[model samples]
Target: MLLSRLTGVSVLGLALLLGACSSTPEKEKVAEQPAAELYKESQIRMEDGNYRSAIAHLEALLSRYPFGPHADQAQLDLISAYYASADNPAALASIDRFIRLNPTHKDIDYALYMRGLVNEDEDRNYFQELFRIDRSDRDPHNIREAFGDYERLLREYPGSKYAPDAALRMTALKNRLARYEVQVAEYYYARDAFVASLGRGKYVLEYMPDTPEVERALELMALCYEELGMEKAQQDTLRVLKLNYPDNEMVLTVGS
Candidate 1:
């Protein structure tokens, strides 16, 4: 009986040792791999749309080979992986770090383009579209940031391959920002807050003058002026609206 108890104790000790050995975690084991192999694996994962795995591999590669020949590309790939996984903060951080570290790199323009693209796509997601929340009332902060990013890209790299697309995106973002102002104006008008509506309308006109929302902004300003008993301002806005948008639907409403 004494020998059997001793044997049981020995088996238990062996079992515990094995359990501890096996519990080291799969990721730690992977960390032992070479950076080149890890980076190549990350590229494959990214191509397969396995962004989480790609991010993991790229992070491992960067940790292992901070100054490797593939370091810059790895950092750029990590940014794209983060963006693909909807990890905007991580993507932004990665892009910023790359730009800071390699300001004069040949691919710096691509980094700037990705920065703008990241901001541009940040507010465009499946859930937002599904709920229709973005179309009606969007936070203009992201749009404005994206616009600024694109502007910087164009200013710094005027002949960049991405300049054309960046320009197009800026135009769309401008309209969206103008539309946000229009939405705010409409909300104020609905609440009988004519002064606030006028302020928002004037902002849209001053900042986003050539946008389609300008007509609505002008109409809102005129209505607010009429509501506030400012007949001179109302007449002046109506004249400008009539001059710019001869067939404006709001012309009839403001005319009366």
Candidate 2:
């Protein structure tokens, strides 16, 4: 009878031990569901092209499970949605936050790429805005700012998929910038403002060399020299202009 009682206690203890082990894993499994469900819902919303709804679902998931497995992916999706929806400022803000939060995330490369993407889009918009301006009210300062942003993206994200796009943008931006300098120089030249025109025109060569404007720059410099009574300087400038742009009508006009 005593042996039977001891056998019963051993069996009962074994059952209890198994139940405890099983319960812990079951609790963990339960804890994991909300995040999984959230991610699933976000994916569904994304597939439907309801980016805002996807973002909301992901945000809710993150709010409830900050350390969930979906956190990194959730961050990326949220920022991408903002970008797709034309919420650049918000996209940039979210990207910045994510970078600060997960500097070492495995998909850091993707984050970097997205950052470049947003900046490229920003540069496109800035130039569009700058170009759309009335010539009567075009601001040199705004053009300069747009150029600066383009340079920043090119410099910072050289390996981005958007690099080619940024390069194309830079080409257009530089041309506009070069043209702006030429226009300013011409304005000064028209008023017999040789000194100011020479300064502004010379600025273009420094900013963008070997362009169509280079001939104009040299021609203007020659004019500045003539106005200043620097005959040797005038002749020397004209010689270089002729050497480089022998076929330009202005060269003939100036020489004649």
**Using TM-score as the measure, which candidate wins?**
1
- Tell me how far candidate 2 lies from the true structure as C-alpha RMSD in angstroms: 21.3
Global lDDT scores for all candidate models: 0.83, 0.69
lDDT of candidate 1 over 1-256, digit per residue (tens) = 0101112335567677568657533442345678789988998988898777888898888888899988888998898888776677988999899999898998888888888878876766544444456674667787888899899989999999989998998999999999999999999999999999999999998998978999999988998999999999999999999989888887766564
Span of 10 residues, lowest total lDDT, candidate 1: 1-10
Pairs of residues clashing in candidate 2:
none
lDDT of 2 at 210: 49
TM-score of each: 0.82, 0.61
lDDT of 2 at 153: 56
Off by over 4 Å in 1: 1-31, 131-134, 253-256
